[model samples]
Target chain A: MANISQPSQGAWTRMLPNSAAAFHRISALLTLAILVIAFSFASPAFLSVNNTLTILLQTSVIGLLGIGMTMVIITGGIDLSVGSVLALSGTVTGMMVKAGVPVVPAMMLGVCMGAACGLFNGFVVTKMKITPFVATLGMMLIARGAALQLTGAAPISQLGEAFGVLGNGALFRVVEMGDNGFPRVIFPGIPYPAILLVVVAIVASYMLRRRAIGRHIYATGSNEEAARLSGVLVDRTKLIAYTLSGALAGVAGNVLMSRLITAQPSEGVMYELDAIAAAVIGGASLMGGVGGISGTMIGAFIIGVLRNGLNMGGVSSFIQQIVIGFVVIGAVYIDQLRNRR
Target chain B: MSQTLQAAARFDAETTPLVEMRGIEKHFGGVVAVDGVSLDLRPGEVVGVLGHNGAGKSCLMRILSGAMAPSRGEIRIAGDVVEMGSPQDARAHGVETIYQTLALADHLDAPSNLFLGRELKTRFGNLDDKRMLAEARKVLATLNPNFTNLKDPVSSLSGGQRQVIAIARAIYFDVKILIMDEPTAALGPSETAMVADLIRKLRAQGIGIFLVSHDMHDVFDLCDRVVVMNKGKLVGAHDIDEVHKDDILSLIIKGELPTDWRPRNLGELEAAR
Candidate 1:
């Protein structure tokens, strides 16, 4: 009824903050683009190809986690243990590789461990009848403590170069040979981690768009009781969401570990906040039933670019935090105003 | 308990009923929500349930729709007893309900809401959104020619449009018994009339309907038979023409027929009809 009158007449209405969900993502994308342009203007180095790739490389971890968080939030649920679960999965994978397990299998096992943690989160949230916030908050502490206890509070080091390929390797590598000097590299096509992010984002976006499970998630989040009466498997939909969130966190953990070649129990301490912030900025409502991978990917870029830009601008890390915090708040405020309209 | 009402029965009750609720009893903790009540709905019949607030009309309907499980009861669809553990089971048995709240996802488009649990999928097991859109347009057009904007979320629709979506959702699938709870409660007069027309159309299509309503006039205009409930007990069911509105009112308020009420003879009932 609200937009029943000549729906296609106003292009301006489509651009407003109170536009459709797709346009909500566009707003986030536009914001990301603006941030990139502004940062390039603020610092010339920010426009360099090397610096651009670095921003995307850093965004891979949070962007992957954002894919899962978007799904969980869309089910009107939250997972606070992704950061800690990432540490746990990374450490477990580290232990496995150190014990002579194949790097790929260890990595797969790591993702499984993350999925297990997520399953626990889902179980507690659904079966134990605990609120998702409290349930996942409890898992957060438990997973972090478990990670520390597993290694006697020591970091797993020297994970070997073979395991590092997933997060540190590059694809389509280009090398130039010249007579002036020895072989010189001309370009690195794409970081393996960034490629991984792209692939995962594509699959996730497809699932949310073209899957029954995806429809159930939106329905459950919009109104759980209505969904139940409509015969939606609400509980199962939520379980799948939290479990997938965990698996993606596991992937991020492996990427982090591969980049560092060390699994630190203290690593990913506040990464959950980053993932949540990215989702919110990407137009995902905290109340759920409204978000997508595209917006979330842009949200991750916004955060990464904002940090790189601020650091380039010679702002302190503390002030960068303050600025990023306000941006998140501003994004939500605009969303609120849109909903009010 | 009346010969005239039996003579005026619109449906052939002797045949196997489409739905048979046997000794349906529901208890919420220490409270008795629905007492031992049994009812039957045959194919193509519209059975209207009349009751006051908390008089157990909703509870009975909820149990029938599989939204709530009766503490003690047996339900049969087409003469086969069923254990309706959830709404999905009820739907599997060709039972669909349009709840009082409409129960539509506010954020999903019409097609998405139309196939909330049971979705159309391609051979690859992915959602067949294109086919769903086409099917939704066809189904909604049959109900309301004015309905457009299948892409917009249900939240943006008008009251009548929302009602149409709810009805379309219920009737789209292989629904045999359509349960409508206060279908016209939120509609304007014209919308209410539209719903009435829809009910009639569905009845003509041989879809047995369970119409739960507070509007007596609507019930009389649409329902073939009416059952009055008071304090979780069924007072009686009467053919629409056999009993006056005041007699049904007495059953609702007092849980009994009026002292001076008498069943009209078959000849008089036939003459009146």
Candidate 2:
């Protein structure tokens, strides 16, 4: 019998092919850097503390949505109903508040409603054996119709000051001197939405990197038949993934409602596209089993930076939409190139 | 060593078989895939199952491994009958199957694949990655001492390496009966030899193995006894020393017993079936 060598032990980084993942992250960083440099030259305010904070705040809602999208995509599934769910949940919260319900309980119910909708999507996909695209597409229409019907196709305004504070309130204040030696208004209070985004991102990163359920998600996405044969409970993993996505969408909706101080039934229209774009840009594979939360967070920031930069550089909104579309295509193309290697 | 003498030996044998499948039958809608087949696997024995493409060898083995339920049969492990509702049920009974496709997640590393569904957990219910890796390394060392790329995904490894991982997964869980389907079908000569050596080691440890293969030489070299099937029916079972290459080949192709063959208790066995 051959003597067994001392088992090699190290961090997971030592186990993984560092170069490939590094290359993807480096390319994303380079793109963000180039954009930052070019925008700093175009708009003097681009690097200012307030503007940077503004970019982060802008990314928070979509970033939250992207976190959920990343998990769904990693499991080889897609959700087209998140945007509609967001609208519906936000409308429900608004209607509850108008009916004298406490803001906290109303928000909790909205989040639960989102989870219920997600569970419904999961049921249709797993139990009814429907394709995720078709099932979620049906849910998208159903949720949107519900949102409109709840509010009579009108926006809900006059939300109380206490509720609005959750979205617009700052965690702390920052004071800085301006060019003229005068006290400039530079308040870098942490946005509540940004704080929630960070918390969700951290939890998602840990779950994907260090948990058994996370490993099962990757395995199921890689090969469903193999996973089932291995006793991986493929259907349960998918259900949890979709349900988590719905809850996050509800959270994003609450943030949006709070920020606007009103709940618009049409508030989250086409937001799913942006969320998907962020996940894809973060190096998530549509085919599944290949992505990370950090990459997705970076992807969300890139979008936020690009929009903010273009808006400050006096670019037209129409042209900005065209540019964003091309960037999504470009990001997916780069992802494909990486995968081929 | 004639068929009649082998039947007499079976009647006198007193040791209980590790697994017994009596009158096993499987039907897929209008097609009868496996019909009234009985097989007994003894401990520490390698039994090679040989058949043509549609002879139902794989289908029958699938039933044994709990991937598919038998239409009509009782499966007894060491004389206790058990229901095999799923692969998990079979594993609980210490039966493991290494499928033709290997049934491994290509994107996961060896250790992750080794504990795919049955992971080692800490007190807090978190995965114990360190312990799993150490155990994976230790188990793999027995199969392939030179296998050091435990961290790379199975997709990056060679075909033989992937096979090693799949086999390791089955053995790691303390399997009593292992069903390997075409294990060496895609392997090179050296890899095939490696698998043969592993099988020898397993037999020494008293594990019963069911080798399903199309390769006649492999069956002859590795199996102590050979069972042949044709048209979803057992043609004959023979001791390796009692049957020649031509005898097994003719039985497989023509689906007929040899002209001079006679069973000691053929009528009794037929009545039992």
Candidate 3:
């Protein structure tokens, strides 16, 4: 137990992702570092302490979602219902708070709402034998419609200021003072959203690397029939993957609701695509069975850093989307090329 | 205590067969895939089953391996009646199978594939990866000393190397009755020889092997007895010395022993026919 999590042997320590995947993992890391460095040079404001924290906070939402997407993709399944589930969960939490329920429990119910939507997606995909793309796509519409109906298409913006603790509220402050006792380079401190993202990332990575179910997820994705024949409960493994994905999306929704201090039914539309892009750019294959949480976090930061740098460099907002799209395609292309060689 | 019983069981193959399947039948809708048939294999014996496509060989083996439920049958392992509802149940009864597809998760490395469902875990139930690695390394070293791609995903391995991984998985756990479907169908000469060596080694260890094969050479070289099936019934069963390769082929192609065939001991063959 004392030696738990240690890499004991040499070649045996090389571990998962194989050699090519290891190369891809490192390449992704280098890509993120290069983005941060290049962006810092491209815009003088990009390297500032204030802007760096902002980039991380902006990354928190999509990065959290990407964690769940990575697990689903590892099993060769996709959860397109993430964005809608997030909106539905957030709306429920906001409504509960507005109706005088406690914030903590209301938020818990909000996250549970996301999990319930995900559970539906799982049942539809597994018990009903529907393909994940179609199943989650159906869920995507169903959750969105539910959120819209509940909110009557109006955003909930009047939640009390006491509800602000979950979003932009600082947990620990980091600030630098000038010689005249005035704050010179003020840091936003570590916000609630960033803290949530860190906790989720650590748990997700630990599960992926150290759990039996995690290994089963890889096996089920790599070759499902093989996993089934090996006595792996394939259906149950898939159910858990979707549920975890939904639970994380729930976490994301609460973070976003906290950040805005409002629940907008229209919020999180197309955010699913961003989450998938982050996982893919981090080296997860759409074909399934290849990716890591660390890579995904870096991938999210790459997107965040890229957008911020572009904004400060006076680039058109529309060009930013085009650039991110190119990066996603290029990342997959490079991975395929490595495999071919 | 159980090890002693297993050791005693290994020597008494002459008295009790390791696997006994009685009145196995499989029906698909109105069609009968396998009619009433029985098969048995003793410890330290290798039996080969041969048939053309759709002759119900695969269907029968699927039931025996716990991949499919028989419409009706009794499967007895080590002289005890057992109900095997899944591959996991079959394995618990000491029956292990290697399919033609090899059934490997191509993206995982050898150790992960070897312990797919049965993983080594710490006290907290997290995967005890270091211990699993050591165990996999130990078992694999005995199988293929030159197998060095332990860290690479199985998809990157060669076909022979992949077969080694599959075989390692089957034998790593405790096994009594081993079923192999077309072990040499996908391998070249050297790899085929490698699998042949493994078969002989398992037999020497007192494990019963049911080799489902189309290759007459593998049938002749490895099996003590050969069984042929046609139209969902046992066409013929023969000792390797008492039968010719062509006779086995004719039984597979025509589902019957040739009209002018001679039998040294007509007891088992005549009874089956």
Candidate 4:
């Protein structure tokens, strides 16, 4: 646990403590232990390799959104519009692809649509002095309306096989060693999108830990007036944060559409709460100035695993919600304890 | 007074002064802060400004540093009159002010704070961090050797180290006239001694200094001349060698030398001491 402290506090050596961060690492390990133990007792299916893959796949979409939310929260802002933006962007991409646009252009247009929405939110928050919630809430309605209007409140289906490959494809054939007659190979099957999520998480971790701009973002979040007095471009920093969050949300929505082979206007209706909760559970503070991508990834995994394990144990969907809600509350209370110390 | 004489005698270089402010006046809202105050600062000289509360010492220095616009005044730097519209204007005209807080960001280290608002950039438009770190080390070596540990964040530094960083920043920016407000206000004896040494080092570099402080001991120890202000008006200017601590106290409180103020008899004062 103490060894892992080096990575956590090395990024902000002065602001945090090595021993204090070690405690957080210990807490994370303890939670993982509890998950493994509980899941092992819940159902035999929860311990299977196939079930683990399902958990990873389920986490990928929310994990992507959580990464961007981490960055936004670190810079002292929130994007309530991300869920609606995701639906809108996915709907637009699905419509464009149905209209004979190439897969590449559709994806590009979808990403641009998300970035444009974020830009509008950024402008309102920075230029007009609107608070983050109010500004992104306004964007939430606008994007929701646009999504419904474009889809006529119906799901757009028949996204081509090539487009669906991003979410549903396995890069290589799965091989087994037993008498199932699946030829054994050096490697097993891996989802391309899952690999992509891992790559994105690694890149985000590197950028946040090793870059000067990353330091500036933390500084702005810690004390905006101090950061500005030190000549950091506060407005520009916030704009970039919000824009990146929107783009990530767009990517998540696209991944979902690619998986389902359709865009539902009702998709991602309340996913923002789940994404925010995942990030907070992972150690991000709503008050800002803390948390990272790696923590958020673990947080997403926790939620995904909980859902999968609960379902396998015959828990009802409503009960699952209640359980997750309690988990969110508990995670936040622990985070507060760590912070106060 | 004798100590001040010895300090001033060491730095007296040329007859002509470096900075001259004539009839400086400033008004804030409906109130007049500085009324017709004139001052002259010579090269390699330490000039102290003393005043009671609301006596316009800060207002006058702010005008000098271009932090504020003087309602009326004429400032001459190196015998040429100059106009100041902003703090940047003061920097362009070789004037720098070091406030009490030092204005160094706690999260940043010495090198970063040394170039805070004006960071050095590489050809690719990124921060020239390597060059900045090297230059910071060089400046610390030349100015304050104790500050060679520049890698530590400013928040971890002591009061003396923070003060040194502020002074080093002014020196790096090529400030000809340094305006320091209460440089050692909260320092202990040793820390204050270190700052006094830094002021002497700056004086040796041929920079003019306008020191605003209420400490007569520091003024008597470092300043060559002292200017006193009372009730938003200039009280009087005195060569530190020609005046005692009582004279400054009297000037600050009453806006004039105390009546019946005379040097104590040496035998009796020595017995008391």
Candidate 5:
């Protein structure tokens, strides 16, 4: 036991390059770079500016949800109802807009509704003493049912052009030379949804790395008993994490609705899985207390690139799903190996 | 014979105790873990609690530390009765506990662990990592001068280093009374000596210490008074200079005072010295 308690000299040398967390993040970035290079070589369209924008736009919704998922996972908890909550939030906004409500108010109400759902989950998990997995699982069913009930199981379409700008509009358009030396319209208009993703990622990363609440979150996840003994309000921290996740899900729902110009009660079905996968691939551990936003963003990009490249290369969506499933498992396996060392 | 000695250790107006736990009782289901055990600790004093595995020493201390609530007890800190509903409550009243497990977040670095729940923040309300790191370095330097790797997570640290960090945390927040449960249980000889010196330093600063341990030598070396418990009941309380090691051993094992002994007064103790 004494020998085990003392770290070996060799282990110190191995850890010198970086801490274990840094190592995981570096490996994640390396994997993403390799994928980008490989995909660019495999498909001519993969490296195009339009295709790059498409990937970022595609990743925006899931990326926002992944940021929230990263926070939840760091506290050693899971929010399985994010997709359902997103669907319900978007459906509510669509229904309100159809009933002649202004777009901005409708979107704000939708976000609030999403936060309310999260607060409910927090109450169930913290106040009622239910496990996070079970509480969020129940919320998943409830939110999905609520979405269907609100929309009468139909899709709400024909939202105004103003609402669509939140998802489809781009800014800072510029022209540049293409790979073939032809003058191409390189309008690098940044999508609003992608902008939202970047802003959320920056805020979340700053909170996790430079804020007291963020430190408390990590401490709470790492060891609840210890945090409690150290005078931390563990319940409040968890409640905030769940609430943030719910609100982000709402934002994702709005982005999806605007991008498609329609809101369906089933629009975000199975999206929670993708969000969780992105966070995990970015190095967020299911066991909690070990993840960050940057890693999660990279993880989100990795998934986005894989899906876009595979589709362009004529790979079936079924095969893409299999590959994604294996990637999630592989990432967690590597995490376990790192922990064991 | 030790009963009179126990009675003499009771609080008086002239020397108010730093902490006084009166009639602490804890029950789990039908089993009584602690049965009306009362203890007192004075400033700049070390009170060693000695007991068998199931003798209720931990339960009594846990109640004082606010980790567990006593079924019935009144805790007075500095002559004022206070409620200990949670560890936060205890800390608010200048009470801190160093648990046997150390209660450290293994994923966090030394500075983070030192300010785990109550972190110092900058003017902008962000965590002031630079300030915390500097403070942690000062604290760690005083405890263990050889410890310099403040960036590694505690999981990567040795048992001794971890113990030092735990101790530093307890003392950093202006602790008036510290409850240490088996602090040196996992340390080597040099590490143990280091802790012993730290304890003496704290004692010099007028902080009260409640040390729960099974090591007889530690009790003899560091304690001013020794309290023995067995089967959920306190058997004896003796001034270190007034009782023999065999007397404490007999009380711990049999839950009874020594047969051929008489409680001696302070003057008698001085004469014996």
Candidate 6:
């Protein structure tokens, strides 16, 4: 009996290759390749190392938030509160640093503040059983109000130089700065913070796809009742996914403040839309049980290029919004098509 | 003749009952789904539960597996009364249920699905991919050695492969009692045979199984004892050797054994139908 069953099981394993993972990867790669080709044709500067690095630098913050968005979406949830959390975290981080608090501790406090806001959203969505869309929407309003009230609706500037350096500074050796004499391409000019984006993507993808906790996220999204029946802590996984998303958004907010040298109460308004768009474009199903960090990273870059390319081509900001709107719709349509099977 | 000898070989000589449920009752919004349903699952015993739709077979299993809270009941594992307020509670008490849908995440691979909801993480909070993949191979080898494509996502697997993963997951968790709901409902002949072999192997390992199946041939082929329920009430339990297929069907549909029931060969039963 063992011998008979062994051959049959081998036949079972030989018959199929588990196409969904491959399909997911292929879709992401296809999107990346298309984006690269389109941008390359649209502008000569798009392929240049300096401009490419600029896109990477610009996408870092969105990429950070996109990782969290991917996890949340994978668990069949959303975090509309991210943008508000970002602004609030930025306000607190900026205030603390400006008040002579140490930079590291202040950054920690800012992230914690974002996590706390996420906890509220998670508790409401999970414990209270509110729909994710509505729960996070309420959180979005509360976070926005808190930011406005704390800063009196004003942009706080003159943040410490240390914090500013984290956003804009890159470790590089300047060979020369002359326009004609050996135009010095700054060696290792990629922003250190930009590397942080790549690292975040790799780590987040590993956790979501490879780990046991990652499997739970997928199971939870696939069927909440089944997952709970399989001994999964369904409510806890959701809470963690939402909290991580908010915390990442907060980190993105700090990165923005570091770059701009100010904590604007309205800095990240509507950024949640961009983050969600990135996750969707990267193959995350709005219904859940799909998505990864690498796809989201590419998605963030695609958005950055769309915005930057339009700007460089002299398109008005209003037109940029129209283009982004069309792109988001097109991406979601393609996602629906891919999901039809 | 050889198959009957092998079938008898499937049951361990020193079998012991692993899980028992008594007086289990569950209700949903003024409707009594399960009431006064009791079952005993012994090691190396495949207990076939037959019932019509809405006859509370699922509700009874759900209460036993802790998927739903029972308004009143006692579940015991190894002679100790257990309260399964949630599915996790049942799991901790060594109970696992595999639903008809398989409940696998289509986007994830077999190893990932096998370890869903209880992943092994490294001390640094990273996924231990190598360890997980290795353990997946080891577990599938022991439970269903024919399963080999550990890296493939579940959606791409055949019907049999998916079922194998679901069963492997239950076995991997060291579940002493396995409850399967309509496991072979949609499989082809070859796939169904594969599942039958898996069930036999699980029984050989001293695991008790409560199989909820509509297939009478499956019950005769795999089960040691048959329990029948009709309209949320238990009819009776009979050892397969003492009763025949018609006797069990009569119990399932009519809630009692037929007065003139007699055992018949599989070919004769099919011919009669």
lDDT of 3 by residue, B123-165 (tens): 9999987988888888888877888778878888888888888
True contacts kept of 2: 0.76
Preferred candidate (TM-score higher): 4 or 5? 5
List per-candidate RMSD values in Å. 3.3, 6.5, 7.6, 7.7, 3.8, 7.9
Model 2 agreement with the true structure over A1-341: per-residue lDDT tens digits: 13343333234235434544456667777888899999999989999978987887899989989998888988999999999999999999999999999999999998998998999999999999999999999999999999999999999999899779778877886668988999765676888888889999999898987888999999988878888878888999999999999999999999999899898899899888899988888888888877778888888988999999999988998998999899889988877665554
Single out the weakest 10-residue window by summed lDDT for candidate 1 chain A: A9-18
By DockQ: ranked, best first: 1, 5, 3, 2, 6, 4
TM-score for candidate 2 (chain B): 0.90
TM-score list, all predictions:
0.94, 0.90, 0.91, 0.73, 0.94, 0.84
Lowest summed lDDT window (length 10), candidate 2 chain B: B3-12
TM-score of the second chain for every model? 0.93, 0.90, 0.90, 0.85, 0.93, 0.84
Clashing pairs in 1: A1-B156, A1-B157
Choose 4 or 6, whichever is better by lDDT. 6
| Model 5 lDDT tens row, A19-55 | 8777778888888899999999998889988899999
Clashing pairs in 5: none
TM-score of chain A of each: 0.93, 0.91, 0.91, 0.89, 0.93, 0.89
Residue A206's lDDT within candidate 4 is 67
Ordered from best to worst TM-score, the candidate numbers read 1, 5, 3, 2, 6, 4
State the lDDT of candidate 3 residue by residue for A1-341, as single tens digits: 54653544433435434477777778888888898888877777888877877887889999989999999999999999899999999999999999999999998999999888888888988899999999999999998999999999999987877667778876667668888999864557777788888999999899999998889889889999899889999888889889988988888988898889898888899989999999998889888889889889888888888888888889998999999999999889978867664
Query: Can you tell me which runs of candidate 4 are displaced by over 4 Å?
Result: A1-22, A175-188, A338-341, B1-182, B207-216, B224-273
TM-score of chain B of 4: 0.85
Candidate with the greatest DockQ versus the true structure: 1
lDDT of 2 by residue, B115-213 (tens): 999989888888899999999999999888889998877887898889988889999998999999999987889878989998998989989999999
TM-score pick, better of 1 and 3: 1
Best by lDDT: 5
lDDT (C-alpha) at residue A36 in model 2: 96
What digit string (tens of lDDT, one per residue) describes model 6 on residues B226-273?
Answer: 777788887767667767777777787787768765444445646768
lDDT at A155 for candidate 2? 96
Docking class of 1: medium
The local distance difference test score of each candidate is 0.89, 0.87, 0.86, 0.79, 0.89, 0.81
